[model samples]
Target: MRSLLVTGGAGFIGANFVRLWARERPADRITVLDALTYAGNRANLANVKAELVVGDIRDEALVDQLLASREVDTIVHFAAESHVDRSISGPDAFVETNVVGTHALLKAARRAWLGDGARRPHRFHHISTDEVYGTLGPEDPPFTETTPYAPNSPYSASKAASDHLVRAYHHTFGLETTTSNCSNNYGPFQFPEKLIPLFLLNALEGRPLPIYGDGMQVRDWLHVEDHCRGIMAVIDRGRPGETYNIGGGAELPNLVVIDTLCRAIDDAFAADPSLTRRFPDAPAARGLPTASLKTFVADRPGHDRRYAIDCSKARDELGYAPRHDFASGFAQTVAWYLANEPWWRAIRDGSYRAAA
Candidate 1:
């Protein structure tokens, strides 16, 4: 069996990718390494059969040991401190995990897979975000692979630093590397801190749905499954040292997405009488309804106004096509949250927080 190492395989997108890949390639030996940080919940990988290694990526000895002993031939790195608000509050962890951790992983990979800068059939695939392109105006075209790096927040800055390191290793030490910057991903297993899940969970709980600024911030939404498919495509067939931009082409303003979620939640509850009684304290109970719960909040510091992606490169090169549009993806995601209350309730009730 081909041995594969997946870093941050317990987090949202990472966990989804792990589950999908495990099912698709059942014979492949999959090893997962995660720090189990506040956002990295092992429960997200409950259905996956990969060998779990609960540890930080910065642990050089552990990483090196895993690579050498496990005979890991391919590394798909998804580990990082990804929250923009949290990054603003605590930039130190972001730098440590995103920049330093990436460096440590590259160093360990070099030692384990190379001898005097010689080539290996093995590969390193770095997963990143389009926020590294910085903010765009309303009229600006979507970002492409060649867009200049102009990261606006600590989170994006850290990712940019990691991207640079990956490129340097590929060029200087001849490491076979490919990097992909994807648009925002929404689907099951996403933590509630993000916009989509946050609103969904809050709407269900009858809590205030906070909308930052005027809620006009534009973002491209890709289903986690589609994003995972794009990553696998890059792993299987992408050119070394090249960057691919993966997007679902479902771009919309934040307010629009919020409204859509409100409608979906209302319809879901209306369809199922059991949900109405299960969430008795919900806004639907107070007659305020999901749409009435929306409350605009102050904008975050250094908030990017727009982020769009030009995914033609991925489509042309990898034959990548997203299967779910925002409507279908959002419906499925909201339904997942409704069906799996225990998964997110633990996250909200301080149980997971205490463990972290």
Candidate 2:
């Protein structure tokens, strides 16, 4: 995999992957094509030196042109409408971007490499989510590579459709493809919609930390950097037409995770009590910890109770293992948001909001 095309490289995981891959493999040239939606930030790639194309994945002409013009040997597809709550509110964008957009990329790839024999290793690595496997019971084992996809929400359902499409293209047309279903990812450059970033921002600002249902939904949290390494591993060593589960082994309930965050926030505040002034609306922090701000909110509809990954295939086959433990990773993540205030503050100020 030399010349590469990374779709959605402006987003959280994609941006991290782009920066990491560039740093690690300086010889390779990466071209990124992103639609730059609400969560997609150009600032995420501030330091990343690569050819950035602001276009939709569904644009067949653009997809084909980039693949062929750049002699792209690998396509690391990360473009998708990925927020579950946003999907619950409006699902059309999910289907359009996740399902139809994937189809467009696959078609373009098939056409781009129809009879070209120059490219030695042509690969399409589709990034996916564990939500495609639906919720798991408390006693049920974690989802393996072979877990049947039973997506519960519009987001996961759309992603499952895209996964199936990739599989079909690989089998029917012999497109070299590998898919990975990963657990929850949290780290730098993440938008405020996700659990960790949202809660972290709210806690830091002394706002009410909303907990859905009992806040007991279990998720295997993978740091964005670890997830990127797992992805690179699959692209380098994975067998074509196979699926891999990339898990962090950091399984924790939502409530417990938030408690950890609370402690981290408290620690940060204990060091500097004047930090509360950053948020104009935040209550004064005499010595109060953020955990006291917890407030229960109505649970989301069709909310999965648990989502975990086995990831043995990735560990044994690709020699992949997550480096970040939950405790330290969680702390580092909090510290990143604390230090990168300008990054998140722009989003908080409505600079990246979708146009009317």
Best by TM-score: 1
Q: Put down candidate 1 lDDT per residue, 295-348, tens digits, no spaces.
A: 999999999999999999999999998999888888899889988999999999
Best by lDDT: 1
lDDT of 2 by residue, 116-160 (tens): 653345999999999999999999999998888899999999999
After superposition, the stretches of candidate 1 with alpha carbons farther than 4 Å from their true spots are 116-118, 353-356
Q: Please give each candidate's TM-score.
A: 0.97, 0.96
Residue 341, model 1, lDDT: 94
CA lDDT of 185 in candidate 1? 92
- In candidate 1, which residue pairs clash? none
In order of listing, the candidates' clash counts read 0, 0
Candidates' C-alpha lDDT: 0.92, 0.90
lDDT of 2: 0.90
